[model samples]
Target chain A: MEQILANGLYLGAQYALIALGLTLIFSLMNVLNFAHGQMYVFGGFVTYTVVAQWGLPFVLGLIASAIILAVMGALIEVFLFRPVIRKSKRDESTMLLAAGIAFFLDAVILLLFGEKQRGVPKIVNGVFNWDMRIIMPYDRILILALAIAMIAGFIALMQYTKAGRAMRALAQDRVAAQLMGVDVDRYSMIGFALGAMLAGLVGGLLVTITGINLGMGGPTSIKAFMMIMIGGAGVISGAIAGGFILGMMESVGLTLLAAYGDITYLVIFASLMVFLAFRPQGLMGKPWG
Target chain B: MTKTYAVLAAFLLTIFVLVPVTISATGRWDLYYTLTSVALLSIGAAGVWLTFYIGRINIGQGAYALMGGYVSAVLMTQAGFSFWATLPLAGIFCAAISVLIGLPILRLRGVYFAMITLVLTEVTRLTALALSITNGAKGITSIPLPGELSIFGLTLIPDFSTMDSPKPAFYLLAVTLMVLTYLVLWRIVNSRLGHLCRSLQQNEELSASIGVNTAYLRVLAYAISSFFGGLAGAVFVAISQSIYPSSFAVTDSVNFMLYCFVGGLGYVGGPILGTFLLYFGWDLLSAAKEYQLLIYSSAMIALMLVLPNGVLSLFDRKGRRK
Candidate 1:
């Protein structure tokens, strides 16, 4: 149970970071940004390239990689999603655009990385010894800490910063915010850029703990996706809560079903299906339908 | 009357006429491969196109394909069921399972629906991976033949001893199921039911206001899609004669999803055309693994930017011009 709790919090941090970015895009732009996973995947490779391959400082690699992807995110918004955003294509089509972007990103990564898993340099190389086998990686703890700090910082920004207030207003109503003299488009771009940055940071943090691979996007994205869908698309705190729930569910469920032979994945998916069916609006978001 | 006959002649000439001449001339046995892969994949692609028509996407179609393939493959390998028996049984089995999944899932709109279906595929894949019934990823191989299955005491097998290649089975796949699916889906698109589905796609609220049973129609579409998917899986089983969870990964599901989108979502020909072009291109491009994902990603980005309506819609718009 302790391990499950720790695992949940640890993995939940990763989920929350990615989900935070996802929620930002969804709330501000009303887009799911399906390719968010691909960005996360790319972040890992870029971090690896900078820190390990180029012999750069780890922090510099994180900062540079995050900035680079943030720029890429802004460009993608301008060239790709801007038209679809204008067309009133609805959430479904926007999701497809996200899927396409992720697919393209993965294809690029696979081409460059050769489909092999590569481990990133651990940010910290110590362990937390709560029990005999309950020793924890210092980097994992760092990841969790980084995730919480990011969210806390995000909350502070949304509440305290001028840009944060503008983002909040845009989230509620882009046109109304526009009428109120907020640059809605710029806020949207900022939201997207920050979201991409968060995803990249999470990707960097993730490789330190779990290692990295081209295969991470589809499955990990689904888990993060479940969090967003369960928590409601645009809610920040909801992402955190949903992440905890999924991580707990996954760790506990995987443990329980290990004794029952198999069918654990089916159970989790079936549960998610039930959640979407019964609680479509989820906890934080309003009923879309 | 003549038009219908002409179309049938084209189909038949391609099957019985053109194919044989090519086989005789080339002696390469390549057309058999192209024909079968196209037929099987089209079934799955069209299944996805059903969800697309209803404004939903089932990334879990891979789950159904994988499930049906594994189920039939396991049964044929372990239980000694002939390939012929597995075909309809597997198809029916998959359709039934898919309907069960669709019941709750069809309620979700847009991306949520897509996510659940995507998760559903993962669930199926992981469960299949863990199940003792599936040999825990060792996969079921050396499946039994359909050699002795007879119609009125006339055996279907001409050469019973050799099980070397899947070429003949591929031709059988092309002639038998693929053509049938094309005709059935074509008819469905033109039916009153088809009009109702398109209406739902345009505006679900509007469809509901006009007395269309929106839920029922979506569910119905869901079942039809699953049925075709099962048929495709059965075809895949026939060709490969073995099954593994990896073959039906979520990537395959997404590829099928892209094919439908790339070829144009609302048409039968879209899947046929898109599946061949995209999948075949993927096969050729598989040579350079490192650059493969990069190319696919760039292609997708370009497609989104340049032709948001998809490759098939280009021809569709032109045909409409006439």
Candidate 2:
């Protein structure tokens, strides 16, 4: 039971980070980046290269991966997403573009890294026993701690910084924000970059906990998208709550059902149908006016 | 429009007549098989196009396809049913499942619905992997070849083992199915229901205020889409003689959506053209080996940006001129 809780919390941290990044982009940009998972996958590979293959310190590799992916995020936004943001309808065109980027990244990753799963060595190798039977690894704790710290830092940044305020303003009302002298374009870049950076950080952290592979992006992206839906689209805090909900459900389902743990996703999907039918706005999301 | 369709029908008829002759004469069964797969995929893509017409993204068609494959495979392997019998049953099964799920979730519009459906495919895949009936990861293999279609053993179509390659008959069957699928779509788009569906796409609120049952229309469109997906999957299983959980992944669902986008979402015939081009185009990229995906994705991005209406629009513009 204790193991289940620990595993759930750890998984929840990764899901929370992924959901936070995805929802941040959705809130600010009003577009879903289907390639977000590819970015996360790339981040994992980068961390694996830096820390595992290159024999660098784990912390340095994490920071490097985050910075590199943030920059790539900015470039992708400006080059791929920005030019087409004004074209046709936002949903269809942007979706196609994001899917293109996703496929492109997947191919690029496959080309660069091949099809092997890579793992990073542990930053600190020790297990702490809370009780006689309950054991926790230092790396797992580090992942959880880093996840919370990064999320806290992100929230602080969004709450305190000038760029963050501009982002919040733009998300609230685009035309009004523009009227009030907020540079929509620049803030969009910043928001996208920051979101990608969070994905990268999470990717790196997840690699340390679980190995990274080429096919991880597609499923990861879907799960993160689900978290956003359950938490309420465009609601930041909702992403966190949704993440924990999914994580707990998965862990508990695995513990109780064992062989039938795969039903967790089906149950979530069915409940999502029910939730959308009855309360489409989700837990933290305000009712759509 | 009649002249264009007449010409297209003649062209399709020419291929239908010539393909078998050429394959048997030259022994290029691979070409016939590829064309057959394209037909099957196009049939599935056409279903997606219907949902697209109704202004909903049907990213979960893969789930239906997988379900259809399982239904057909199970019926064939265990129940000793003929493939022809399983085909309609697959479509009905998928359509029923879609209506069950579609009624509740179809109310959520845009990305919300798309996201949920996206998760639905993954869930279905996992379910297939875990289920006993699906054979649990190893998948049902050596699924018997479809039997002869006959009334009282008249043998209208030869059995799979008796055929030289099964490609010619499969191609003809797939083409017949493809033609039927599009005919339904074309008829739907021209009928009153199709107009109602198009109206929902344009302005759901206005349609709803005017007493159009928007929910019913959405569910109907979705159910039809899944039916087509299931039909295609049934055909696909017959061609491959097997079914695996991994056969239809979430990526294929994404690619199906892409097929519609690249084919031209404005017309019923778009996905048919899109699926053929993409399947063949991706095959052509095999020479690049590792860089194939990178180049393919780049081409997709460029194509969407430059020709948002799809490759068909190039012909659409030309056809409009004269």
Candidate maximizing TM-score: 2
* lDDT, model 1, position A23: 82
lDDT per residue (tens digit) for residues B101-153 in model 1: 78877877776777777777777778778888988788777665556557897
Poorly placed runs, candidate 2 (over 4 Å): A259-261, A286-289, B21-27, B152-154, B315-322
- True-contact fraction in model 2 equals 0.70
Q: Provide the lDDT at B17 for model 1.
A: 70
Which pairs clash (backbone N, Cα, C closer than 3 Å) in model 2? none
CAPRI rating of model 1:
medium
Residue runs of model 1 more than 4 Å from their true location after superposition:
A84-97, A111-114, A130-134, A173-184, A261-264, B1-12, B155-166, B286-289, B319-322
For model 2, residues B261-315, the per-residue Cα lDDT tens digits are: 8888887788878888888989889998878889889998888778766777788
Q: Model 1: DockQ against the native?
A: 0.55
lDDT of each: 0.77, 0.86
Q: TM-score of every model?
A: 0.91, 0.96
Candidate 1 per-residue lDDT over residues A59-113, each given as its tens digit: 8878876997899899888778888666423445555577778877877777677
